[model samples]
Target: MHVAEEQKPAKKSSKVKWIILLLVLLLLAGGGAGAYWWFFLRQPPAQAEQAATEADKNATKGAGKTDTAKSEGRLTTLPPFLVNLADPAGRRYLKLSMDVEVNAPAAVKEIEGQTAKVRDAIILLLSGKSYTELAAPEGKLLLKNEVADRLNQILGAPRVTRVYFTEFVIQ
Candidate 1:
C-alpha cells in the first residue's frame, strides 16, 4: 500500500512534466513564428515598390503587350438627333447631342460606317421616352447607359466605355 501510494505521485509528476514541456515547446514555436513575420513578412515601402515593379516587368515579359483597357480611348461625336419625345399632348421635342468613348481608334471608322443604324437606334430609343421620363437626372443617366449598351450591342462588344451628353434639351 505504501509503495503504490509513492508510485502514484511519481506518475502524476511525470504527466505534469510532460504537460509543462509541451507548453514550453508551443510557446517557443509561436515566438519564433512572430519573429519571422516581423523580420521578413513586414516589407518597407521601398521594397514593396521594387517588388511591384519586378512583378510588373515579369507580367509585361509574359504578355508581350500593353494592357488595352488602361489605354487612353478615343472619342467620336455623333450627329445631333432631333427627335419627338412621347407625350400625352404629342408636342414634346428633344434635341440631344452625344459623344461616345470608343476603346480603339479604329472603331471610329466602324462607327461612321454604321452611322445610319446607330442614328436610327438612338432615334427609336429617344422617341419612345415620355417627357416625364426624360425630366429627371436618374432618367438622363438611364438614357446614357441604355445608349451605351445599345451601341455596344451594335459593335457586338463593349467598344464604348462612356457616353457624354454634350447637349440635352427638351421642349
Candidate 2:
C-alpha cells in the first residue's frame, strides 16, 4: 500500500510537470506572435503624423505661389463607390473613396465635369474585381494604375498623375 501511494504521487507530479511545460511553451509562442505583429503588421502612426506635418508645411510654402502654380498639384476627390465584388458568393462588397491627382489644374475641372462617366467607369471596374484581387498590396497598386488609366481614357489625355485611396473597406 505504501509503494502504490508513492507511485500515484509520482504519476501526478509527472502530469503536473507536463502541464506546466505546455503552459510555458504556449506563453512563449503567444509572446513571439505579439512581438511580430507589433513590429511588422502594425502601421506606424508617427510616420503618418510626420507626413501630415510635411504636407502642411508644403501648403504654407505654396501659399505665395501664383494661382496656376498652386493649382498645378491640385487633387479632385471622387464620390464614394459601393459595389458587390465578383466573388462566387456574391455577398462580399467594397466601399472606396479616392482623390485623383492631375498633372495640371485644368484636369480637375474636366474630371468634375465628367463625374458621371468617371463614377460609372469606376463602379463597373470595382464590381468586376474579386475580393482576392484587391486584398494584397500589389493588387492595390495595380488597381491604382488601372484607375489612372481609366480616368485618362475618359479625359482623352494622360492627365491623371496619381490616384490616392482615401477610404477603402471590404465587407
lDDT of each: 0.91, 0.92
Indicate which candidate wins on TM-score: 2
Residue 138, candidate 2: alpha-carbon lDDT? 94
For candidate 2, write residues 60-142 as lDDT tens digits.
77888443344446789999999999999999999999998998878999999998999999999999999999999998999
Model 2 misses residue 168 by how many Å? 0.5
Model 1, residue 142: displacement in angstroms? 0.2
Poorly placed runs, candidate 1 (over 4 Å): 1-69
lDDT of 1: 0.91
Model 1 collision count: 0
* Candidate 1 TM-score over all chains jointly: 0.60
lDDT (tens digit, per residue) of candidate 1 on 1-171: 999999999999999999999999999999999999989898988999988987886798688876554555799999999999889898999999999999988788889999988999999999999988989999999999999999988888889989999999999
Candidate 2: list runs displaced more than 4 Å. Answer: 1-72
- Worst window of 10 by summed lDDT in candidate 2: 65-74
